[model samples]
Target: MNNLKYSICYISFFFLFMLSMVNFMMMIHFIMNNMVIFLEWEIISLNSTMIIMSILLDWMSLLFMMFVFLISSVVIYYSKSYMSSELNLSRFIILVLLFVSSMMLLIISPNIISILLGWDGLGLVSYLLVIYYQNLKSYNAGMLTALSNRIGDVLILMVVSWMLNYGSWNYIFYLEFMKNDWEMKMISSMIILAAMTKSAQIPFSSWLPAAMAAPTPVSALVHSSTLVTAGVYLLNRFNYLLVDTLPLKILLLMSGLTMFMAGISANYEFDLKKIIALSTLSQLGLMMSILSMGLPDLAFFHLLTHAMFKALLFMCAGVIIHLMSDMQDIRFMGGISIYIPLTSLCMNISNMALCGVPFLAGFYSKDLILEMVSFSNLNLMVFFLYYISTGLTMFYTIRLTMYLMVNDFNLISVYNLYDEDYIMLKSMFILLLMSVVSGSFLSWMVFSYPYMIYLPFNLKMMVIYVSLMGGLLGYLISNMMIHSMNKFIQTYNLSSFLSLMWFMPNLSTYGLSYYFLNFGQNLLKIMDMGWSEIYGGYGMMKIVKKYSIFHGVFEMNNLKIYLFSFILWMFFVLLMLMM
Candidate 1:
């Protein structure tokens, strides 16, 4: 049975890898030839309306599909070892396959209705995956994840209904024509809102971290390529409608705040997976803000490159967690590099890539994004948000590295930690290779010409400067200790706010629902148990009882009442006859 489960994983890994290769080649072909193929299947036609399913085969979709398949393939292979002891490993693998298929459906779709099919599939499957552990935390996280994405699903449905104006569901064809119209603005606004919910910008950001209840393999696929990126991908496709629009401007501000907020939040985070999840959130903000700047291509570039390293980072974290007896807190982890050198090496590489170290995968894209930010005529607030967020990226990365690699081992004295699991190591190595080379490869393939960036020397060095300062702070802060008292207690409120993602989780869950729940309780008291009960069931019972009492009185006096009535009738009849 275990062998059969393993075989299922291996077979999935093989086919997905082959598909990724094919998609990669096709993406290159489409890019070189500047071609787009739209295949439409008409499901129904009524009057002047048509419900057609349209598939868009372009370089962008193909490239994204390739990356999705590649990461999914690696994640599945890694899960075989990660979940080897589980009795229901086959169920896990099947869910992952379903997720990948849904993502593919989303990528190929150019119609709103079809997109919703894929969109809702992602939400539902993700909810299932999040609660895979069948624990309280997993259940709560799954509900949060599902409900948050449901907002997006609803927005998409609204867009579908609004698109009925065109008598067709193929939104790609109407993007330009609808750009200047009021209805188009409404549609675009809804689309942006939907995307924001899925990508988890600002108010919607809580679910991404909560979703860490999912298995690490799911995190690797969902956070890195498929689920979170779906929103960004949708926005990128609709970039034309967003140019010089109010919704785009608001998205810019929200995404910037989201990036900065996540970076700050990650620094204060202790959980290994949550910190990584927060970093994913931060990178997502960067992609969104860039896309909002009217450079969807650059956003797409960063998205692809980010996927390579972020997935690798999660895989490394997974391996470490597995070996550490499921210990996720960084405070209990240190100097594991001495015990498991290969995993540490992979972890360090991925972390550096995440921090945008020179010449690595992230540098090619992140550095370009910073330079582009400098080139654009943006305000100081936006400027600082971008640079500071970059620094915070380095800050958390350095702190995380120190905690896991540099410091002394703070866990049990006697334990075995070895990097002998080749199945897991092999999967990590594939992503490790991609994390090193994918940036430059994608830079060359995606863009025909390099961006022309011109900036002053100070602005040019801003990213490096902020990064160095952030790294320095990270090192110093991690080394400091508070004697005789907990440091967080000294600044309880500030620490609470920062560590808790600015109370976003609280606001999203309790804060938003508190009033509604309170109102519901009031309704139950005043309606269901109060006026409603009186006028409804309780009142009807009272009326029925009163009638029953009146009937009982009549029955008790029945003979006396009958004799009196007969005497009155006889006297009245005699009087009438004499008249």
Candidate 2:
């Protein structure tokens, strides 16, 4: 029975993937001819749009799905053993299939409603799987993660509402709307708020670290490579919508803030998995900023390259924890190069890729993003700021690589290489291979027509040189600083001014619902405390939670408050109904 279920997932995955692949080939053929389908047909609503099934075939959609399939397949195979001691195998496999299906659907969705449905569905499956452990911490983290996603959804829904009313329900309609309207600015702003929340952007990012409660395979599959990137994916999917709007500028601001903070968080985080998790947040922010600039091609390339190195890194981290009695703290891991030579080798290469060493995969993709930022004609000052942040990314990436592979600190016994897992090694090496050449391949494609898209190769080389040097310098600083101080570089909290250091975007069970409630509580206190001083010239004002007319009105839960909000919305609904 277990074999039957396992076979079912593998079969379904391949079949759907092939179907999407064929659809994509057809789409590219259509796109080259500038064909546009009317996404909706009342006769059957059966418009076969290219974007609708791009999950397997469209250049942008297919690129991301490649990462999805690569990591997810290995995860399933790895899980065959990882879950060997567990019961409920079928249930787990089913959820994994559902999760993959949702992501594929999202990638190819031709319309906004379809995309949102897929987005919400993916979040639900991820939440279910995240709590797969059902331990106290896992359950808490799952519930918290779910709440954060819901908050993001709320922001998206708000934008959808505005677009449908002021713009149009169809996503393709944004191009037309942008030509004649300003309302898209508000819609874009709202949509990006949703994006930030989904990507685990700053202040809202704690859910990702908490998400480490799930199995490592899930970490590599859902959290790192696929679902967490959905928000950025959406932003890129509609790159044209933000082309030259104020919302695009706002997105740039959010991107810078998120990347800077995420890098800092990664710097100080102690857990191996959490460090990667934080790094995912930081990199996704960098990706989002790049996407916000209307550089779809660059964003897609980065997505592909990041998946290769990140998966390799996480798989190695999994092996590290497994061997050291599930030791996840970086402090507890050192001199690891001795025992697991194969893993050490893979980790060393993967670390180099992450640090953007030239000739490595990261060097190309990350360098393209920075070079583009340096040269975009419209925003000179903004590009300069982004360039500076790229330098920050360089510093942190070097810090991480040095701590894992080269440092003389925290020496410990290294176990023998875990060659029992050949698939794991193969997966890591495949990514490493791609990491080395993806940039070159992408560069060749772009430079195919130099007059049309002239890449500043000379300038690009200089930037790469500077980026690599920055990483080396940062690594050296950590090395010398560590030996002299005899302590971890993170001990001093070098990035304390980043206020997000102390706050979690969605820390506990209480989320926006709690925030709104607290807002009301404070407002009521302000009125109660100040009313007597203003009205009667200073008798005491009671501090009380007891029922008063205004207190009752103010203390209603989110539902009733929403109910009253519905009354205001009724005016609009009735107005529409009357019209």
> CA lDDT of each candidate?
0.93, 0.68
Report the C-alpha lDDT of model 1 over 1-579, residue by residue, as the tens digit: 878999999999999999999999999888888999999999888897888889999999999999999999999999999998889999999999999999999999999998999999999999999999999999989988887898999999999999888778888987887789898899999999999999999899999999999999999999999999999999999999999998898999999999999999998899999999999999999999999999999999999999999999999999899888999999999998998999999999999999999999999999999999999988999999999999999989999999999998888888779999999999999999999999999999988998778788988888899999999878877877533333653377988888899999999788765566688999999999999888998999999999999888867868888788789999999999999
List the lowest-lDDT window of 10 residues for candidate 2. 48-57
- Model 1 RMSD vs true structure: 4.2
Off by over 4 Å in 2: 1-57, 163-168, 377-388, 392-394, 406-417, 444-502, 505-579
Which of the numbered candidates is closest to the native, going by highest lDDT?
1
TM-scores for all candidates: the values are 0.90, 0.75
Error of 2 at 524 (Å): 18
Model 1, stretches more than 4 Å misplaced? 481-490, 514-579
Model 2 lDDT, full chain set: 0.68
Please write out the lDDT profile of model 2 over residues 1-579, one tens digit for every residue: 767766765675466446546655554554465444443433233234222321223555654665677667666665565565567766886788788888887786656666777889888998998899888988888977887788888876776567655333566545554743667666767777788778877657778878888888778776656788888888776666678777677777777777767666665666888877777777787788888788867777777677777777788888777777777777656666766778788877777777677778777778667766656774655664565556666776676666665664353554443545665566566656766776676555433333233466766565656566567656776567546433444345543434234465444446664777688888877786666555553542333423365678766666878788789899999999999
